[model samples]
Target chain A: MILERQLRDELKQYASSQQCPPDMHARLRQQMEQAMGKGAFRPARFRRGVMAAAISAALLLPAAAFAGNPMLADRIYGSFEQLKKKMTAVTMEQYAALAGKLSGAQAQLGEKEYARYEALLKQYVRAAYEYGNGKGYIDFDALPAEKRAEMKQLLRELQPYFDRLNGERSAKEVLSPEAFDRYIEAQMTYQTVLAQAGIEAGQRFTSQDIPAHLRDRFEKAEAVIREVSRATDPRR
Target chain B: MNEWEVQQLLKRLAAGDLAAFDRIYEMTFQDVYRTLSLLLVNRGDIEDVMNEVYVGMWLSLPRYDPGRPFRYWLHGLIVRKAQDWRRKAWRRLRLLKRANWAKGTDGWTDDSVLAAETRQEVLTLVRRLPYKLRVVIILRYYHDYTLEEMAELLQIPLGTVKSRHHHALKKLRRQLEERPQGKVASTDDLGTTTT
Candidate 1:
């Protein structure tokens, strides 16, 4: 009983000192907005009619047809090109491959700081990558209702970008041709990873963030995006 | 807000009310953070996990029983999410070929003194306990769940929770016993997580 009391008291102290990030609600609100989409929460009867119509339209359309706006795709691709320089890759495997490039940066850090920074980086990547890749993670079709609803609670600023890669998504803000959409979304997601990494890395990583190996991924992901753009070009 | 009011907010939330979400978040974000902080030692994972927990709450809101206290329901969801997060973390480790990040955290957990003069220091020792044992301690002490409650929330047998609680306290007691002369002991074996 005494041991239990001591443990409880210690835990209570830790709990008292804890606080959440200030901007957590605002960020959540923004993500929920994107996930639900505008006009999605209309009256149930209206929603039913619209959903039925969508289903009908989907059935009528050719299997080759893809959803999303070219203009939006352009903006997404443009953003990726710009974002390539600022951040890192999506998975640890991707980053590990680029370890050599970050050696100079690692050399500057004290052992403890590097440990803390690297630990934070992994968490940041996992969180932001999971958050941004919400719908994309499941490919929409595979996501259970509970799982899909969970994604609705996460960041979806890259909804359109994620949709293309994941397959059969309904976002007006997307690019077309399943293959091309996949490419654009992949690059956008990569940039988003780097962008989140910048936040986690703080001053040091942001200052010396760009490594040649990561840059190659940028070129490849962007090159794919650009190629898709040319293929989807209305003028061509 | 009272349970009734929170239930009403949850209703609105299910209807896609962002205002209700914002309000519920205001009331519960601290608890959410504390619950996660206890479960996950990494500060960074807490923020991201908070995102999952809140969203999980929203998704799970439909099934929430208004008769029960909201806090317990929320804690249940948080524990489940942390479990999911831990599983994913192991998977994430596989992808990270050179998991040097795993370095600073893993050191000595074999017969290390955990005499902590300060509260934070002592808690660090608690954090060092293996994940299974550490979680039982946190759930029982920090979250204040009854053994039966933890068993229910964790979907494990009650006896297992009992044994783990006993095992953890025994491990902790061995470490918390101060060395002679009040001299500080080396932390070589004090790293979090032991087999």
Candidate 2:
């Protein structure tokens, strides 16, 4: 009991001495104000209110105008398609640039580098849509056996980049080495899950086949990718 | 700021008052930053995570209950964001490793080196604990959270929290008692004292 009390007191003393950066409050306030100004920090209720108003305004628009001008609807649809294509192109460019950098670099990257890598990975699904011979699928099985083998070999070649990226990222974000190792182990488990489900790189799988925890991770990964895609969309 | 003041600020923030948001930021940034610094090794990442936490809080403020402790909610959000950052980092690293990329050391800033040099031995050991135990210790000692509070915050049973706390202290005690005199062992993860 005495030892525990002593340890607690020592810890309390240490905690009291820890201080944040002197400029943290000022910087955070600036960021919060900026975010609020941009509507990025708007409460959900405000967004919903705005959305409701927009919907109401749209409903009030003349139905006769749309009925008389079929070309108007066509134009809107065409513009939407064009915007999507533009977004896909931008996302692809961003991913390709980051992936190329990772491919060429020999050294472990900093947080910025790891963030770029993450943003690139998040675009992987979109890249499949943009680059997969216009078939909207990453048809690895469609390739000749030799080509498939080459693709696998290329993935193998990229493994070290992934490892080093993890090492640097783990070093940056995770305080505990043991926790970082568990994260790596979780990645391995994800791979095992994929293998068991007969899923290969660039292939999609049914969410139902994934374990619950792994499925959550997979969904989060997709969400990150989608978020990156939206953030980089030129039309946005 | 007290809970009542924070709640008032949050109410104004939810009403779209930028000044209220700024006030909340001023009141809570230190606590948030300190918590993040202890959790994240990379100073740059800590700043990023801190920004993310604020943004997340702002986005979810409508659902926040004024009756609840704002600090607890904010801490929970920070923990979740940090975990997300960690997972993303791990995923990218695993991909690089699978590609056979040679691992190299990241370049450190002068500030980071100085910070590492100043880290206390006990803090270093605390950081070496497994994640589950480390979080419990950090909350109990660093944040001054009660064990019951920790159990509720972590969504774990009280028994689990007590077990983790016990295991963490035992590990710390063993590490301290077993150290040889005049020979300080280097910890790679703590980024401390070893060039």
The candidate that wins on lDDT is 1
Model 2 / residue A70 / CA error / Å? 66
Candidate 1 local lDDT, B157-184, one digit each (tens): 9888888877777777666666244224
Range of the 10 consecutive residues with the lowest summed lDDT in candidate 2 chain A: A45-54
Q: Write the per-residue lDDT of candidate 1 for residues A1-236, one digit (tens) a residue.
A: 44555667878887787777677778677756654565333111100111111111111111111222333212222332322232332222222212321232234355565454444333333433344322112232234667544433332322332222223243333345566345534444434434333322211122234455565654465455445434433333
Candidate 1: give the clashing pairs: A87-A194, A88-A194, B108-B189, B128-B192
Maximum-TM-score candidate: 1
TM-score of each: 0.50, 0.48
List model 2 lDDT by residue over B5-117, tens digit each: 88888889877787887777778777787777666543435665776788788788888877667777887788777766654432322111011111121211123343367
Error of 2 at A71 (Å): 64
Poorly placed runs, candidate 2 (over 4 Å): A1-19, A22-27, A37-236, B91-116, B182-195
- Which residue runs does candidate 1 get wrong by more than 4 Å? A38-236, B90-119, B178-195
